[model samples]
Target: MDARTQWDAGRSEEWADVTPDAARRLLTAAVQAFAERGYHATTTRDIAGRAGMSPAALYIHYRTKEELLYRISGIGHRLALGIVSRARDGGGDPAGRLSAAVQDFVRWHAEHHTTARVVQYELGALGEEHHAEIVALRRETDAAVRSIVEDGVAAGEFDVPDVRGTTRAVLSLCIDVARWFREDGKHTPGEVGELYADLALRMVGYAHK
Candidate 1:
């Protein structure tokens, strides 16, 4: 595994700062359990056991299992936005920036498949308020991608037919990496990233130009 392809185990001190150590353990454990057994099928006992705590110990940190889902989902969304924002705004032309954005976004989804699966596909499992909040975060990603496409068009670097549709397609392709990517698969995250970046460029008529 290339260091760049490391699955972000969500071990950041930032998340740890807001969440107590035990609570954070539960969250990490929940991500794996939920990813393995799914949100509906996974029990609090499963989560607690995975965290090496009694079932009742879970309540000390979270009111319910859905609460755990919300926190993980929130963290996942922020991580997605943070990565794309950097790729979008950090040094590059429109095409260069969009390529970097697609590559990195796809890599993260593929590398962090378990967490990304829950985040991208399991939003419906959250409470109404939590779902809404996650949707807002998703919109930020959509906007960032769209803006890059717009910039490409404005600069005559891309020949897109529908900026909005194209942006959605680009992100959909990247997000779907979580669904099928496997560690035993042929491509590394870096390889997938490179391949997807080229595909993104081609999608906008980079080669056609």
Candidate 2:
């Protein structure tokens, strides 16, 4: 099957009987297994064991490891896109939208560190066909940010010479925060989000004064 078909098929699994709390446990276990054992090495049994469910029970929810991985990855991409969409719909100027986007990006990654880690590190572990779907989602995210930067430059709200490069820099800055941010770290998620928003604004040549 093609990537979109594969993703759609995977998402069609029935979670109607699964309570919100149980669903969270399942996703949490999936993320931990993917992160600890790597996607290629993780199995449904591994996740089941981690979540204290039987292998048969796990199968009832997820037929394969790839499906679980796709679900986790898909959620991360959707979360990022949702944040950007909300910012754009907020009817703000370029700088306000950019600041909102940056804040949302940082906060999401900080709160969902394991999900972010699995999304970033285990993408290659997806089946070749499934990898394409994930890549497409990622590209859409890149394009959204690039378009934002281009709009900012055109509107004279920012002075970036390279929209693509600036977009990559801004995204990388947010994505990498998951690698080092800790709940007990010197900065809380809100603090880190504001700091990164400031840095991203400066990078795009927005005057913060």
Per-candidate clashes, comma-separated? 0, 0
* TM-score, one value per model: 0.92, 0.86
Stretches of candidate 2 exceeding 4 Å from the true structure: 1-24
Question: Looking at model 2, which ten-residue stretch has the lowest summed lDDT?
Answer: 7-16
Task: Provide the clash count, candidate 1.
Answer: 0
Q: For candidate 2, write residues 38-144 as lDDT tens digits.
A: 88787788888888888888777777888888888877787787787777667667888888889988877776666688888788878888889889888888887
Question: Candidate 1, after superposition: displacement of residue 168 in Å?
Answer: 0.5
**Candidate 1 on 35-151: residue-level lDDT in tens?**
988899999999999999998999999899999999999988998998899987987789889989998898788878888898877788999999899999999999988899998
The whole-model C-alpha lDDT of candidate 2 against the native structure comes to: 0.78
Q: Tell me the whole-model lDDT of each prediction, alpha carbons only.
A: 0.86, 0.78
RMSD of each: 2.3, 8.1
Strongest candidate by TM-score: 1
